[model samples]
Target: MTEITLETRIAKSDEIVAGKIDDEFVMMSIDNGKYYLMNPTGSRIWALLDEPRTIGELCAVLTGEFKITAADCQKEVVEFIDQLAARQVVKVG
Candidate 1:
């Protein structure tokens, strides 16, 4: 089985808001009123925001779905989560 290093475990997804705008997706946290613009790849991650997922799982999923490098995906995934954290969209479990 794959593992995830998710810093935040989304128990209640109500805290975050998601919607599509034009060709892009946007997710916002009602708690902090902070919004994140989700690109194609980011949107994929957003779609999988039901619960906590390990970094490895995310990396594997992304790599399998897209033609991206695992290392690159890992870095981006961590950075994206960091951005979400900065906005208080997610919290450490």
Candidate 2:
């Protein structure tokens, strides 16, 4: 398993087809044939992943936009990215 750190780079998978519906971001994984629905924060993260970015960079942007502390933002973003990677919705490098 690849360990994700602050320096880890991430981006949405090419095989993912996504769109926004109402307030949710929905996506389908071509490789896995699975669907995912992301909340507002997750949607924001997905949008940010339009290009590969370091985990620390993501936390920096998210901390400024959301009402969370740096520590909490990092923790949650890491966990969220872990889930996205497991689902093959995102790739980590």
lDDT (Cα atoms) of all candidates against the true structure: 0.68, 0.92
TM-score of each: 0.72, 0.95
Q: Number of clashing residue pairs in every model?
A: 4, 0
Q: List the residue pairs that clash in candidate 2.
A: none
Best candidate per lDDT, number? Answer: 2
lDDT of 2: 0.92
Q: Cα RMSDs of all predictions?
A: 4.6, 0.8
Cα lDDT tens digits, model 2, 1-93, are: 589999999988999999998767999989878889999999999999988999999999999998999999999999999999988888998
Q: How many backbone overlaps does candidate 2 show? A: 0
Q: How many backbone clashes does candidate 1 have?
A: 4
Residues 1-93 of candidate 1 have per-residue lDDT tens digits of: 112254334332568888887757787778778777878877777667666666666677889999888888877787877666656665544
Off by over 4 Å in 1: 1-14
Worst ten in a row by lDDT for model 1: 1-10
